[model samples]
Target: MSGSEPAPVEDRRDSWEGPVPIPSGANETFWEATLEGELLYQRCEECGTSQLYPRAVCTGCGTTDPPFETSEGVGTVYSYTVCHVPGEPGFSDRTPYAVAAVALEEGPRLLALLDCDPEAVEVGMPLEVTFWQVSEEAAIPVFVPR
Candidate 1:
């Protein structure tokens, strides 16, 4: 697993009203790693494919238990949307935020909140991962300009 130093962190546990993730099944390790300011993805040792949204079974090969890899936490914006209207619960106060599908350098894409003014985002903009510790069980990945 290749990684840089632990990324920046912003503790949102006290103020977060959003839906906190409850780690279960294969994603437990993924969520656990977030607290340490690390981004994890699954890479199939058998087929050499990388994927996000950790799963018990590998997507490329039917290999059970693909190994985990730590990301460098750097990526570029693949696509994005500026939401003027709140899309999820607890986000009403955060209307007009940018959400992006970030294409990680490690070859997996992750959907995350882009932590900046919505107007500042651009396609292909370079980003680095950050974590918002929303709960004791998990933290959510957020991105910002690199």
Candidate 2:
């Protein structure tokens, strides 16, 4: 698929075992982009700050309805932790997974699953985005070392 198009969900059974992302309001476009293999963040037109967990108002300038922008899906690990305990249901089987706070190239920092051995990731490491489609309307962004 083209860069603008998301990779198709491989199978519906392999994503998160916890409560899935439900698209709502300002977050709806963000989730929709994931299905097409795109990552999105909201940018404040007034102050030029970009953010994630999409919001209706810009935190930077208090502007209502910031515009959505597509991310390049590239980032660097700012920090991370290995999860020995399941954070949610069905995650017990995924012990030793990594959860990372990544600083995207565009300036937004997002928390995402790291698709690599817990011992294999490091702060400042470069990463690229991949999606784990969990529901018809949402796909969780995961990262892999680049």
Compared with the true structure, what per-residue lDDT tens digits does model 2 show for residues 1-146?
Answer: 23565544444446557668889988999998888788889889899989997998998989999999888888899999999998888789889899999999989999998989889898999998888888888888888888
- Predicted structure with the largest TM-score when compared to the true one: 1
What candidate 2 gets wrong by more than 4 Å, as runs, is 1-9, 14-16
Q: TM-score, each model?
A: 0.96, 0.92
List lDDT for all candidates, in order: 0.92, 0.85
Q: Give the TM-score comparing model 2 with the true structure, all chains together.
A: 0.92
Model 1: per-residue lDDT, tens digit, 1-146?
12568876679999999889999999999999999999999999989999999999988878998999999999999999999888889999998899999999989998999999899999999999999999998999999898
Kindly give the stretch of ten consecutive residues in candidate 2 with the minimal lDDT sum. 1-10
lDDT of model 1, residue 84: 89
